[model samples]
Target: MRAQGRAPTTDGAASATDTRNALDLAARPLGGFEAATAGFTLFAAPLSRVLDVELSALEAQGRGQIVSSPRVVTADRVKAIVEQGSELPYQAKVGNGVSGVQFRRATLKLEVEPQITPDGRVVLDLDVTKDSIGEPTAAGPAIHTKHVQTRVEVENGGTVAIGGIYEQLNRDDVTRVPLLGKIPVLGALFRHRARRDQRSELVVFITPTVVGTQCETSGAGDAEAGKRGPEAGGAGSTRQPLCQ
Candidate 1:
């Protein structure tokens, strides 16, 4: 931290020291394959270092009644957005656009072998265990699935997983885990770190077909329309992007 008046306050927070330190450690990579767990611990946690975009629609007015929707945004609506909106087979009924048998998404025991770049960027080398013996499936068609890896970056809360998680592993994630994870102020730091990690894991996306309109819409439809009469020459409502 800078001394009092020496530095001006800014809108964004500075990156944490733990993140930088972990990045340095991850970049060098002292040990061999045996260090895999430790490597992940850094990148995905803070003990190690690891790290690793839209569209169109509608019209209105004499200008085609131009439907000028630049983007859609949502916050705190993750429940409806993810779980309820998961692209599953059940939603695609006979006439619901998608067709054929929708195989239920199966949960597999995924083991991630971590990889790190010279610059400390982390990636995952995935392995699947068919059973307790950790046998690989042979003489069979391979499972086509999204590879889940948490690329860690040295940033605010030390190590952060920049991949699909929490969304997959639903829970309140605090930075440090187990034992010393609950040590007062330091624990608070860990909480921040965990949140930062979780923040890093956030899934951002864009598409032309709009969805989950419930978050933004407010007021009555007729009243909203009344405000946008010919004299007004403005859209009755507006949409904002997630970044906002």
Candidate 2:
């Protein structure tokens, strides 16, 4: 009697399969898991000051206004927030009886998070919001807002800018004799018409600088040295700027 046996597995085939998988993984790019401590400077200004000009040049010239400068010390991918403005109150009425007062924020808020790449570049995730209260009506004050969300990559100490919000003004003037200006058709010869138009835009600029790593061994050593005092070659000692 002959016994039946299962087909034998080939070691060479198994080895080839393992090799292919290892190669695939080796060729794949790894995700960035490193976060960095960073400092951010934000600016809000008129478009005329920033238009058609390099942001770096504008910053070097100190032509743009600085609105917020926030430093993020936590490297846990948490965002840094900057908010400035007022709260507006409005009456809440129920069937002609005042029930309560509600408040709304009219503010300029910014949220930013910085991540470091393998090549030493900085990646910035930003959200910008600007709100303004307009003329009040019978019910409540009108709210005008402009909002933007964006992601940008820049070298350390580099500047990036964004702008689109605009405002336009128009004015008309009739210069004529007092009585002649009041007349409809008969005053045409005596009246002169003049008009003026003006326009402006709001712009935002951002600059991100990677400071030191939160969990870096060198940084921890520096901190320890800083606490050791000058007699131990610690106090009054300076480290080179990490972001330039």
Candidate 3:
């Protein structure tokens, strides 16, 4: 089914440390950061679009179609899925905003203005430091952003970038195949491994969506959904939620 809606309207990135180490993102501690980033762009982003073109394309191919309600899970939701390691509910949008487009350059991720959403924003963040064991302890190093429109005049409108999307699907092929999602054992296994792995990787948030990593305001509402905060699905560690 197709549903039409106006884009969130307001939304909107970047730097290099002069060289490779400075400009790298995909090379993060992994189960494969780039793969997950790409997967979200292909599988998740299009699905989140108002038109849901990709899913429609699948239906057009005589593929099975899913009858699901339309809801946009916010960044609050993404944090929950990653932190709590839970399955995202059926909805049009997962997380408060759109997952940004991630580009892979060997190990590092080169973010791009998404072809899907030209007006989308992005943010890069990382904080990998050696722990007592000399192992990298990846922490909250996400580059944060927000936008305020300033007219270049009164006619042409060029918006500035604010933050970025957090992509979780690590592989294009895996999420693309609707058939695999239907398999029982395989699907469960895949989801478990995927969620566990997703929270472990680094992030690149594409803006318009704010990182609501807090416990209180992270979408906590109603009796069924509960808090929907970091407590619901948040960093496994003790870091405070960003949204809060």
- The parts of candidate 1 lying over 4 Å away from their true place are 1-15, 19-21, 25-87, 90-101, 104-109, 113-244
TM-scores vs. true structure, each candidate: 0.19, 0.51, 0.18
Off by over 4 Å in 2: 1-76, 94-99, 171-196, 213-244
Question: Which 10 successive residues of model 2 have the least lDDT summed?
Answer: 1-10
Model 1's TM-score against the true structure: 0.19
Q: Tens digits of per-residue lDDT for model 3 on 75-148?
A: 31122111101121222333567543332111222212111122232222221111111122232122322211
In model 2, what are the clashing residue pairs, if there are any? none
RMSD of each: 25.9, 21.5, 24.6
Model 1, C-alpha of 151: deviation from truth (Å): 12
**Model 3 regions more than 4 Å off:** 1-51, 67-70, 73-244
Query: Per-residue error at 102 for model 1, in Å?
Result: 2.4
Clashes of each: 12, 0, 37
Question: If the candidates were sorted by their TM-score against the true structure, best first, what order would they fall in?
Answer: 2, 1, 3
Residue-level lDDT of model 2, residues 125-182, one tens digit each, is 7677878888797667977887777665655555555455455658898789889767
lDDT of 1 by residue, 1-244 (tens): 0000000111122433444443324432233433223223233333322221001111111111211112223222121111111222222345766555443343323333333335533333333211111213432223334333322223222332222321222244445656566887666654544322212122211111112323333456445556667454355444332221
In angstroms, how far off is 163's CA in candidate 2?
Answer: 1.6
